[model samples]
Target: MVFDVVCIGHLAKDRIVRGSEEYEAPGGACYYGSFVLRALGLRVAVVTRLAREDLPLFEELDSIGVSLFPVQVPETSGIENIHPDPDSDRRICRPRGFAGGFRAEDLPPGIEARLFYLGPIMPGEVPLDFLRHVASLGPVALDVQGILRRLRDGELVIAPREDQGEYLKLATYLKADDVEAKALSGVSSLEDAAPLIAAQGPREVVLTHREGVLVLADGEFHRFPFKPRSLAGRTGRGDTCFSAYLGRRLLGDPPREAARFAAALTTLKLERPGPFRGSLEEVTRLLASP
Candidate 1:
């Protein structure tokens, strides 16, 4: 079957801790992004792996009309995020479990998509050859977080990938947050880092920061601020923003318009936990204002 986008990643059962408060939630770019795409009226499919016990978690995706291609492994991948400051982006990430890596057989045969989104939750979850194979299928939108962050001893460390140039060349669209961009390009400015990353091969680079979303496409830069009322749902900010941006792009919106739509959609997402639950009308309304 043909789909607007195919998301490949590991489903995560994330444990979030903020001082005296703690809770568990479903996570991963595929988990968050599929919902955003579906909400924008795009057909979506997800290829993921997790423990058999976590199979029921996919019910949410099914409810949203997202096709699932799940492969059950012995363990479900997870992370424990300890946030000492609720207002800050700093966090201590520890690996809880890893579901193992993907193989060619994991992707369903006969499935076609306009865009393939690769959003692994950690290193090794997606390998180089696998990325190359997917890129051959169609346009690829990649989130570099999973590749840049690796499990070190017991904690998650964010660092530049040794072969990032090779991987970046495979992606048509790239997503990276300010922190991740800094680590990969050795530049602190999003405007500067976006072009540097894009120089590797991606035609477009989407960079998310605490204050806004920035897009550099075809040698031009576009930006829009995220006016979230609160930071209640900050965990999947980049995932939501990137998905919203691509959803609009697929619908024929230019980089400036797509960036604005993404920022507005992501602002609404920031006011709630979990994947985006707001309507397109709401996003349109937000965009029309000011």
Candidate 2:
């Protein structure tokens, strides 16, 4: 079957800790991104790996009309995010469990998509060869976090990959948060990092910072700020922003407009503690406002 996007990643069982309070939730870029794409009225399919017992976590995606191609592995991937301060955006993430990696055989045969989004949660989840295979099928929008993130002793560390340029060259679009971008490009500013990252091969680059989202497309830069009333849902900020931007671009919106719409959509998402549940009309209304 043909789909607007085929998202490949590990479905995470994330444990979020804010001081003494803690909760487990289903997460990962695929989990958050698929919801944003579907909410934008796009036909979406997810190719994910998780434990058999955790299969029920995908029911939420199924209920929303998202097609699932789940690969049951030995364990479900997860992370324990410890937020030290309630008022700060700083958090320390540690490895919980890893579901293993993806191979070409894991993909459903005869599947086709306009875009393939690779959002692996940790190193080796989606290998380079698998990324090459997916890019051969169509455009790839890659979230580079998984590629750069490594498990060190027990902590999750974001470091630069030696073969990063190789992976970047295969992606049609690339998504990186401020930290990842800095790690990848050695440039501190997102505005400077975007074009340098784009030069590696991606035609467009999307960089998300604490304040806003930025897109560098066609040699021009576009930016939009996040005006959330609160940052309760900051966990999936980059995932939501990247997916929303791609959805709008797929619908033929220019980079500037797509960036604006994505920013507004993500702002709403930040106000809530889950995948985006806001309507397009709500985004439109937010866009219309000052």
Candidate 3:
């Protein structure tokens, strides 16, 4: 079945530490992205693998609004070591290789979308040929951090983009934080990072600096400032921001409005402690004129 938006990636049980006992949640771009879109009033679907033991979470997702593009794999899980700091948060992500990714041949017989979001499990995890096919299907939006992020002594580190530059052009939108923005663009400041990332590929680029967020689209640049929340206990804010941006766009909001709405949504998520804790009401309230 065709979907308004489909996010394909790995979903794993995340053990995040912030306040007291370690907390657990299903974590991954596909999980967070589809959840946010469903909350935003969209028909969203997710294609991911879950171990037999973790099947209940997927069932919970289905009971909500998200449809499943299931991929069965016996060994499927991701482990994350998160150390949340006010200024710097470190996450060591390990995809057990249990999920081999959904191959192009396995895609729905003839399914298509106005939007396709691919958050790679690792560098080149989706394969260049598959990326080309997905981009050809429709406008593509990518969270490029997965391509550049690697585990360094169980701490998240970024490797310079050596060969995946070609895939960036396949994306209609590129979303990354100020650091990933610098890594992708080789620029120092967020202001400089915008043009550099836009020139790399994608018609639009959004850089989420700690202070605020910036959007470069249609030969113009726009920024939405926020009262930066103290989210010293969670991860996945970047993924949350991108999904909201696309959710608003697909719902007929203009680019500026989309960016504004996303900024507010992200701020709400920041206040919460986990990836998907913030609800539709909190985000909507944040978006209201203040």
Candidate 4:
């Protein structure tokens, strides 16, 4: 069946540490983003690689009506996120396990979507050639961080993409946090970087930062401030924003409107853990408020 969005990436088993508390949770761009899309009532499918032992972690997705096509591998890509403060987006990232890269053949035959979201959690996880093939299938909403993030000396580092133009050209909508945007364009600010990234080819660029989200589309720039009560669920902020924004876009909201809706929706997600559980009415209410 054709889906609204097909999320392609590794399903991660993340080890999250906040002060004295620590726990293992399902993460990765695909893991968090697909959940948000599905929760928004979009028809979502996930294509990911993970070990059989870790397959149980996907039960939440299955229960939520998300169609998951998981490829069993020797390992599941993962990371250990060290949060010094429980309410901070800042964290120390360490490489844990890597399932490996995806190939074109890994995509199920005849599966299709109106939007393809590349959610790779590490550089090279979704090979360039594979991404090119997905672009042929539909408009791509990409999380640029995965392709630009690398494991260096056991720490997570950003490596500027030498062929940023190629990837940007293939994507219809692109997402990056301020750090990733700076690394990609060598610009200190998102205002400067968003336009540069958009020029490469994505019609829309979603640049998220501490204060809020910046959306650049059709030569116009829009900013939406986030008002989360707390940052308890900061880990998936980027994933949540990108998925919710694209979901709203596909549902017929304009660029600026979509960005606002995403910011409000993500604000609620940040107050809790896992995917967003708030009702659509709640988000609509938040969007309508001053």
Candidate number of the best lDDT: 2
Model 2 agreement with the true structure over 55-101: per-residue lDDT tens digits: 98779999999999988888999988888886577888898899888
- Model 3 TM-score on a 0 to 1 scale: 0.89
> Between candidates 1 and 4, which one is better according to TM-score?
1
Model 4: weakest 10-residue lDDT segment is 271-280
What lDDT score goes with residue 184 in model 3?
A: 82
Quote the lDDT for 43 in model 2.
96
Candidate 2 error regions (>4 Å): none
User: Residue 167's C-alpha lDDT in candidate 1?
Assistant: 89
Instruction: Identify the candidate with maximal TM-score.
Output: 2
Worst 10 residues of 2 by lDDT: 81-90
Q: Give the count of colliding residue pairs in each prediction.
A: 0, 0, 0, 0
Error of 3 at 30 (Å): 1.3
Q: What C-alpha lDDT do the candidate models reach, one value each?
A: 0.90, 0.91, 0.74, 0.88
Q: In model 4, which regions exceed 4 Å deviation?
A: none
lDDT of 4 by residue, 59-135 (tens): 98889899999888898888898999887778989989898899888899999999999987877797888889999
Q: After superposition, how far is residue 38 of candidate 2 from its true place, in Å?
A: 0.6
C-alpha lDDT (0 to 100) for residue 239 of candidate 3: 80
